[model samples]
Target chain A: MPRQRPPAIRIALCLAALAAGLLPWWNAREMAKSAFPGFEVTAPSAGESGEPAFFKKTVVNPFSPHKKSHSASLVRMEDGRMFAAWYAGSGECAPDVAVYLASTDAAGNWQAPRAIFNREKAMADLGRNVISVGNALLLADGNRLGLLFVTVAAGRWSGSSMNIAWSDDAGMTWSRAQNLTMNPLANLSALPRNPASPLAGGGWAVPVYEEFLGKFPEVLWLLPRGGGYDFAVSRVAGGVSVMQAALVPLSRTDAVCLMRDFRPAQFMSISSTADAGRTWTPPQATELPNKDSGICGARLPDGSILAAYNDRSTGKRENLRLAVSGDGGKTWKRVATLEEEPGFEFSYPSMVCDPDGTVRMLYSARQTQIVYVEFNTAWLKEQEVLQ
Target chain B: MSTLTVFLLVVWFFQRVLPVRGLLGLGVSTAAGAAFVFIPWLGFWIKSLAPNASIPMVGLLLAAILGRACNKSVFRPADWKAAWIFGAAASLMLYPSALGLGAFDTYSLGWPWLFHSVSIALFAGVGVASAVLLWLGNRFGYLLLLAGLGYLAGFQESTNFWDYVLDPLFGAVSLVALIAMAWRSRNPRPANPRGTTAP
Candidate 1:
């Protein structure tokens, strides 16, 4: 018979894992209570302007010469601009395809569509590859914008590599694009950092989910060093993928990122990184069950973390809801349904809380149309938390 | 780059590029070095194939490498069979694109032979080799031709070989199958003098 492993070793491992999982929760609740301070929503939203907050029928290619769109990422420029970037073409992997960007003023009115990146130029230099951008951020550093996304020059989606481009003056003027990595298929990206991330020796690091040869999803570091991930005993709050990772700084060695595990039933997944993003606490499930749609996360004024995603487990992004995490990310209570019924199918929630602490969100329904929701932290607190 | 650098580049490329990577290239290089170390195959091949063999063999080597890499390590050794099938399917996936109905890129053929032939052969061969290997198994010595065929995967610089390398959630499926295989391997059926039992 194969030698049975020692019982003590097994017990030790189990206890260690249990302790590791619980420690973050105990700490996060305290941090959330302190940081979130409180939250609410705006009474009259941009939707009041002839358009409702929810556009449940999004076209696959709303502006394409033909019409086929897929894969999107949303970000808030430091100037308080809301930009939604997505791939618009005949198909997800077609050549005529190009990455497009659209934005809304702080008031929530969307600008017209425009191309920001293309494959023709990418391949002319990087060899014939496909380039797609995701999660662009306007860092305080040099007021420089950071663009993170995947590129596939040699094959298809799997050949994806992370690449970036930047704009100095907000989203107006751009910078030459650069390759961030050679690893293909890096997905669902976000940059989160506290005072001590390893890349910054304790700063911000881009956290993107990777599901290559590996089973569970893990976030990798994208700054300080342009290499692989830094591993440790702890992990982000949960085991999830296409994770909507948002960073909230509470203290040194502690931060909360609102995450959604890819589980159809277990909606809310939040992870914490103690020694920066190098290691994370296993994510815990919340009352919110994911509607099988992607979510987006951001920080608010009073220190609360804002997360938007399909609230239900079925149907469309229709139930896209906003909730605040008062206790770091340990617990979440719903704020409001940015989209109500007859307006369901509203999904792929992307959110950003302005400097004044006001909240804004972008989403699409039926994959045919796009919509934006405007709210205030105060209005949200009045609404019920989904729990 | 010099001939030596290109050869060295080939070595590193094979070792690093492919997703379902096998040490076949490294192993082959070692074997060749060993031939020179003793048997005289490397020196003989060098004298025989020389400069002309470099380009064609490089392309074949790419296809074989990709073909072999896509074999088992790419997916999980257990589901190497499925991945082989998928890869073969992908290779044959040449549909009506920018090039009409023809396989390989007509664009490159208009440009360079080294670029064109290598690109088409590797892409087409990998899909064929992977499918043939899995459905057929190691029986026909197809795997023997793997490293030789892998170089073909990247004949066109723009080719997306990562599908064979990383794939999407296929890795997770492979992980499950591997765990099952390992578990099965560990828990073997005990022999009974009395013979058969329930599965």
Candidate 2:
């Protein structure tokens, strides 16, 4: 027979195991508290134009001959100019698909879209034949701008990998593309669908999701380390399938993420990270409806949250609605209907608030054109009243 | 023919020139590899049905073919156990995180220092374990060393350490072998009575 340990030793070993189990929980809790020490909710003022009322709409890629142009992301440069990026090609996931960029001048005139990167160039640079390219995301890291996109190598979504290029002089000229060494196999298929949320520390929290084999979301925090940036990934807890997270910074350290539900629910999933995106609570469903399409969220100047999403839970991709949340994304009131046609597919909205309190939203009107919309809080309030 | 098919055909021709007992085995294995690569009917069907083939898998199949041509086991029982262990461990780490079932994202560790350290430690541990097994008259150590060399030489299309070690094919094979072993252990054959075994 095997000899039994002493009662005292067994008790000590059990205690050690219990402590080890509780260590992560305690660390996460402490980190959350330290990150968001005094979290509070501030409501937006009623029917006040914090800035001049401006409402402008235009077609970003009006003359592109490509069969499809979608997945647009908008970024505001330091010089008050706005640049929008989207992938255009023969169709979705085509080998010829490339990331294109266009910018708005000071007079609000949209420039012609130019192909910045494509599969041919990327394949030559990486020394591997890239199957396709999609999911073009523009991130602003201080004076420097970064372009993040996905390259499918094995002609399948599961074989996708992330590639990035940086432009120091805004979106004029970009550096050579480099593959993100996230895995040895580089089989981690992730695509960024939203702009980077500025973290309290010297970094940005960019929302990315894995689309192959698994459909879920994770936050890539690009922290400034050594002389450049190093990425740290934080997995969002809960939810069987979620993707394309749009992050909204509630406070300096606290933030909420809105994700598109890929499961059968067709409802937008929400998760909150209080420790500057180090850890997050499990995602739960929001009251807002989603049609398994991309959504965009931005923090307004008046401390209001602006969200653009498809209004219907299940149907054709129609009725793109814009809503404002005063209480940190807990609840939202529909302010304006961006698109309400029954047959038209209008989705993948990306928004950025300008210094003049103008909210610029760029979305795909159909698969053919990129639609741009600029509105102010006063315009949103008037639309709310009309609704 | 596709590049994969051409490569396998060349391997088959080379093996056929050698003095081997089962030339048909080489032809059969080459036919299977060719079927998977050039035969669109079967290749597309398998890709659509399973869709998790990686570069490492092709390497393993090629190794098996070469081993057969040389009249030796590429992966002995212990080597199969090692592959099984690797496959099962990778499946547990990757599938759950891929499915969004956990908080700790194993994929995140792919690029960090933690991943490099873990990879190195795993390599060392497998080396030590293989050495012990070899001292006890097991050939798994040699196969493990071969795998380590293959990884170091960057044989797989993917640069991920996990990719070189395991994929869905190995995982499924490991699971099946484990189950079969358990079943056999549960119903062990009766010992021969006083050395009177059947010829």
Candidate 3:
């Protein structure tokens, strides 16, 4: 099997074989899904290489730095080393908090965790709203790390904005944390994005959600300017009422923003732009199934779309799930449960597919634990089975 | 499946099986299960409790008591050592690919350790499920096995466990093991009664 075949032939054959074997997967297709021309999904038999399993765990408290910890995000670097960070809180949503780090070998085993950045200064400078820095992250070219998190500058869970941090040495040392917000708002998160993929100007979008007056979520493009996050926000909406927006990149000139109505059980609104993230049309309600639950959306390379959400407007956030959009964001069919019953709280789920094809999903349910799932273009392309 | 079909399925399954009481049982057991997986310190304790799962774990206590009353040989044991061989081979093949070996990569290229750990748990769950399904008769067993598998592909994955949970490997291994066991049983050679067989 190894010697008889030329190296290139073998490589091409394997790729072709996988692409062919995964014929059942439709994500490779475009237009009507039957339009897929080049690649096919190659799902290995269960006992084969595609089998699904857990990677490894890092308590983040490996150093037992603080008395508590919660809300973690993981990133696998170019070298196959896994880096994880989380907020160490004295209690759920507590003020005495700081984000920490841990690394894993290629096999996924975790190393001891350390404090990538502390909250004492941010907490003192801005008050305790700067709880922990990275509940979400954006890793960039040249080994830069971008993170955003929520903190209360005013009241509990009240004040939130974006903050950015980085480590050239994977936490051996990190640059000092800086705020990503233009001015302080209620809350913000670095909307997750794929790595090694370019942005409009080599900068990435840090999703900021506001709470005060007219405080809404905006897609803020952050470029690594002058060794800090030089940030700018796109008006996700004029009113602070429009919040919990889902973003998807269609092309260099287009992006989709799915904004939701402030009222519960209402239709989710959409605001899209043909000129990249510069501007978006006014949001209107859509028939997509969103149980007033928060939603996360992403664009598949095949032009199909994926949204993480609940079925009805009132399903438990942990009852949250995945839905696919075959025709842009026009409609969606519920795909799979991001988290199910026994763990009925997988909320605020963040998803990103790293360059190596691993899809990372992070969510906080029953106390801020991240549940990650991965599949090739093949698995996702399977005829969706909705609930 | 359509939304209506799934809605019906959920209603039917939940109405029939997920009673308030069952929900409570699920809650308690699930919490226990989560502790068993997430708390690394308790792994040995759980492993020691479920050794020799010749039968699956769910039915162990009942099966032990019933073993004395029931006839020992339900079906002639087959020569089933092949199951282990297939299982080990499958493991060797899939394990490396998952561990970022042999240039075959699925997810887990970049992920947090918790995500990786959880991905392993999902596959492990699929493994245990397929094993139990194997004894429940073949046609429906394959269906349950697929459901177990679907649970796996549905989640982002990590490199851990045998890349496969319940799969052709299970069927292949079971076939071999059963055949080996039957061959041994049909030609039972009297050991020197010391519980050792060399002949």
DockQ of predictions, in order shown? 0.03, 0.13, 0.01
Highest DockQ model number:
2
Better of 1 and 3 by DockQ: 1
Estimated TM-score per prediction?
Answer: 0.50, 0.72, 0.49
Model 3 bad stretches (over 4 Å) = A1-76, A91-93, A110-113, A121-136, A184-198, A224-229, A354-358, A381-387, B1-199
For model 1, residues A1-387, the per-residue Cα lDDT tens digits are 123347675444434333322332332333222221111222222322222232222332344453544445555654656566665666655666666667665665666777766676555433323444222332333334554445544345434454556666555655665554322222212222111112323224444443333223334333321332211111243222435455554444556665655665556666666654445566667666774456777656555667776776445555666776777777777776666665536656655555555555556554545555566655565565433
Sort by DockQ, top down from the best: 2, 1, 3
Write down the RMSD of all candidates, one decimal each. Answer: 18.1, 8.7, 26.5
Best by TM-score: 2
Question: Would you give me the overall lDDT of model 3?
Answer: 0.44
Fnat, 2 decimals, each candidate = 0.02, 0.17, 0.00
Score candidate 1 by DockQ.
Answer: 0.03
Candidate 3 C-alpha lDDT tens digits along A1-387: 112345565444434323322321222122111110111122222222353433322233434535445455655566766666666656644556666666766666666665555556554433223433434454545465545544434333334444555667656765555544232111222233222123643555544444444435555554544555333444555553456666666666666676655656466666776765545676767676554556666666555667766556445454766677777677777765545675356555556554333455555555444344555444443425324
* Selected candidate, larger TM-score, 1 vs 3: 1
Residue-level lDDT of model 3, residues B1-199, one tens digit each, is 1112222223323333443433454444344444445454333222212111111111222222222224232222221232343344444443333322322122221111212332333334334434433433222223334433332353211111222222222434445665676698899867676877462
Ranking by lDDT: 2, 3, 1
